[model samples]
Target: MYRFLITTSKGLEQLLQQEIQHLLPEIETRNRPGQVVFEAELADAYRLCLWSRLANRVLLQLRSGKGETGDELYDLANKVNWSSHFSADQSFSIDFVGTSRAINNTQFGAMKIKDAIVDHFKDLFDTRPNVEKQFPDLKFHGRLNKEGFGIYLDLSGGSLHQRRYRERAGRAPIKENLAFAVLMRSGWVDAIRNGDESSAEIPVFDPMCGSGTILIEAAQYAAKIAPGLHRHQWGFSHWKGHDIPLWFSLLDEAKVGQITPSMRFLGTDIDAHVIEIAKDNANIADVGDFIQFEVADATQQPNTFEKAGYIVSNVPYGERLGELTELLPMFKSWGGHLKQAFPEWHLSLLTSDRDMLRQLRLMAGKEYQFINGNIECQLVNFHLDEKNCHIADKEQDNHSDFANRLRKNISKLKKWLKTANTDCYRVYDADLPEYNVAIDVYGDWVVVQEYAAPKNIPKHKTISRLQDILIAIPDIMQIEPSQLVLKTRQVQKGKAQYQKLDKSSDELIVHENGAKFAVNLHDYLDTGLFLDHRDVRQKVRQMSKDKRVLNLFAYTGSVSVFAALGGAKSVTTVDMSNTYLNWAKRNLALNGIKGAYQYPLVRKDCLTWIRECEQQFDLIFVDPPSFSNSKNMQGSWDVQRDHAGFLRLVRMRLAPGGTIIFSNNLRQFKLDPDLQDSLGLRITDISAESIPFDFKRNQKIHHCWVMQDDA
Candidate 1:
């Protein structure tokens, strides 16, 4: 029997473990912060790698992570029968992560084990094995922390966070794992499966389920479906030790447990466009019947939910979110009406600002305070009691309490923004009267949308006051503050542009992750920068130094910039559009970098460039659009369809010792076996993990590796 460890980032460990165990019930399952250890056949590893969604890597637990020093790491790795895993002629790569003091540099530590494996092969076979950085047939994993390190072969060869489901996204949308964490924290899983909560007898709901992550996760969890069952590989299958029949038997067992569930879980967002998106997501998840969503305000529809249920929402908070002065009073009225309307339904509202918490006078239950990504929010839950109606008589006092809380939160954000050095692109209710949400800008991005309450007075209309006073101040000050373009139930979302008095100067870059990044504070839906891929850039920094790095289909040169920063010998960034190539130069120059350090940003088509270029590269980062076309690169470019061709181009240009990190947003990808069969270059799926924690939404991202070898 072999032990397979399905690993995931923290928070979603339980959900993934539950799903894995449910699939292989006979396996001995043990859960940890980042992994789930189970005893299973090699075939089970193959099945899990292809199908598991939450696992970052499916590894064969060769060593129980008990080693401390780097030498001990090598000794432990060398202990593995090298011949049992890879042939003397074969190659491999080791990925180091979460190491402790014993292993300081991940790359340095990973190399030690790689050396050991090679030495083991040399000592036994009288010849050394090769180290393939790009796509090794076997991936050895070293996960170390305060405890020790776990040495194993990365069966999935990729992280499993990328489930590939989301087709589009909105600004600052919550991530899938965190969304799953939220649902898990809300006890929605148990409530849905049991048809009621331990404390309340009502249904669980997301009044503002923006991406349908909450609903989809709930359905997927309650049903005993393995998150990976829908995907193509189970990493274990790739290992020599994997047993095919055992893997299929596990799949068969999981399939038998599938049942159409009966539950009344629902979601509603005020935006109709998002409602359409939610429906699309529901269809893709195949849980359309299990969930229902529509356009309704969070406060408006709780009255419709006859049965008492949990009402949870990630509501508006910050200046980019728009002025909450009007919304604040609305919340008071909503809570009061909630008492008169649905006396028993519990309301749990999450907000970044503390003011929203006080405004939501949920008197009964205690609050669960935790950080959601970076936004610190409070999940205020309240159980309803009929007698609390007059208890609502403290309504006047509640208004004063809101005023006090509002002042504290406003001051807190004002200071937070200044220290964080962020920019402001969101000015809510700029056209409305008596609304005040003045946002400041820094780092050319909207990092803080400060909320300050407009002074109360028996004065002109609120919208008029906003246009004259709020907008006028910014206009008079010569600061161009763009109107907030958020999805709301209110009349219109406004046109997608900067609504300043004068034309503003803002440089926006749309990241492949679909994030709108900007260089200046101007009018834009967002400033395009994917901060989450910071680690990917970190990877490039280490690899590109003193080496020729190629960035294929490069978008604004994010990876290129990092590579240059890492002291790359020379860089050639390719793209079809001359416009983006120019922008890439500007982005690089903006960071005070200029020179042939990165030679000739090319405007040639990538497919053609790869075919024509006679040079080889030491490192390459390929992130192609899911679909696009140009004159030189005409017709459709589907990553799933064209990945093989792209890989061929990469393999052709890659240096003997080079590595290429190829990424795409295509949720499902099948390796073109013909490329491996016909071309003889090795390849593996490394996509599941390419999606960062912030960018994750099961199946939205896919990754792979292409490697060339020599005898």
Candidate 2:
């Protein structure tokens, strides 16, 4: 028997534990910061190494040893019975994780330990052991924790989480462990595993199953498919103490348990090509014989399953999905379909968009807050019935969010609106004046007036001031310009800029730098104009000439205009929204620019559009929405989750000498550091000077980066 520890991202620890627990009837799983430790015999370890979706690495316990420093650790490790683990002809490697007072240097400790093992062998058998860093027969694991030290042998070659089925990358795919948690929470897989695979007790359906991970998992579990049957190698096989006969017998036993289920799992995705990938993945996992995969829109009919079953969904939630207006209907439509078609089914929806969650008609039965990698998300469980259980006419949500300042200060503004002879408006007035902000929704314009005292004024001089409080309340918070009801807003204040073209425009400003060329401005109130990135634009402009440039989300084509103005031979501009695409065209015409915009006027969602294309530019520009949910783009696509996919998609299109400028306004912009090595992409943070002068609220409005492929 092998004792195995599977490591996962710190965030998915609970989820991984649940997955392990669900896998075996008496499975003992323990979790630490970034790992899940389990009691696995030789077979269990081998099975885990092959099948764990959540476990990052599976480590088998070796001889436990302790030490203070490198020398001490080496001396301790040297005392281990190596002859029983490996022969003199075999090679080995040592990996170390450090924390603690005694050993601060991991490499130093590993080298010392490696030396000790070799020297120990030399002392016993008159020959030193070989050091194989890349692929060693036996891998040793050592960790120097704050309190004490521990040692183990890495049984999993790559990592337990590496399902080995995904061909390359699927867009914003759910992590394996989280998928398991979602499945377990829904109770579908449990029913099947508990003796109901043939009954259709609750047909498990993943409507937005991109690559069919959950579906695959359910099929494997129902079929009694041991997760560890597909691996090429495991660390235990090389260990001297490994029970090879026991492992072989266990594999044969588990293999014999495979069921050619009549019809147990179903996975559907909207994108046809993606569905094909999911099918390919099922085949790779050897579950193709038992699982079914297909292409179907979760939001549309005919594709929707009417059978009372469990539905697990993860829809689009960000810019790639469209905007809030688009996302709202998607939620409503999905809710309507589920309620109408599957009354007996329960649903577990995983998403990060709070706005979308608020739109769901189903009363949330329970919710589990978990992370999908870096993003915080909610796993909302919906107990489905034919209708809302305690159903009543849902009132239009006229009440301000309590979290909204408007609610806190509603009474004060109520008084002011009456005195000021203002009717039909959102009034929020309070003595805690700092929190006071009043807003009136006039047809086309929303008049948001603020009240704050001026610093000081002489008694003789007339002084009046209206501080900007409604600044946080954007005019287009919930609707589009077409949807905008533009009743006139009558505010008793300074004259308006004659409705200063509130929408993004065609005019763009240019900033030039020597190394590359980029736009100083776009049509967006944000070129398509983020004034915060003035310095970055200056860098792009300077670097523009003779550089092939590509700009994504190229609103009003500002970057393209700038690159052209900077004398680049060609510039490509891609945007998903037609309004923005045409705006780019208009900006180009306004700037007297041409080239690159001729063919690739990508109207499809940027993420999807980029995924299908293969064209490279010397310098590529990527600036997408910080947060948006538009249905036209198919689904929500958060930049953070979508960033790597976007980078991968766009980098493949970049020329050998090209570079990509990735920018987003997300305040807590987290550029995945792993992207550098994982995607062969290098990003340099250029957020410091991206802000422009005119719109200077902060020195940094967004984080910008210059991404380059390895030369």
Q: 1-711, model 1: which lDDT tens digit per residue?
A: 787777776656777787677556777788987668878776666666645555677777777557778888888787778687667776677778766566768887888888888788778878987778886667788777777767887777656655556666444466555556565556554565555343333466777788676677666655655556655643444567666677778778778877765446688887888878878877776677778888887666646554766666666665433454335545655667677777766666666665554545657466555455566666666766776554643323324332333344445455544543223322222222234333333332233222333446533433333322332333222333343222222211222121231245545443232122334333333233434344466677877779989998886677787787788899888887665677678877766667854566888878777888899888888877666644456565667788877777778887887777776645465556687665454555554554443233333435545454432
CA lDDT scores, all candidates in order = 0.61, 0.62
- Candidate 2 — worst ten consecutive residues by lDDT sum? 462-471
Candidate 2, 76-145: lDDT as tens digits:
7776777878889999999988845666678877887788788878888999778999989988888776
The all-Cα superposition gives candidate 2 an RMSD in Å to the true structure of 19.1
Backbone Cα, N, C clashes tallied per candidate: 46, 67
Worst 10 residues of 1 by lDDT: 485-494
Candidate 2's C-alpha runs over 4 A off are 1-44, 47-54, 65-68, 125-127, 195-201, 262-264, 302-306, 319-325, 386-525, 528-711
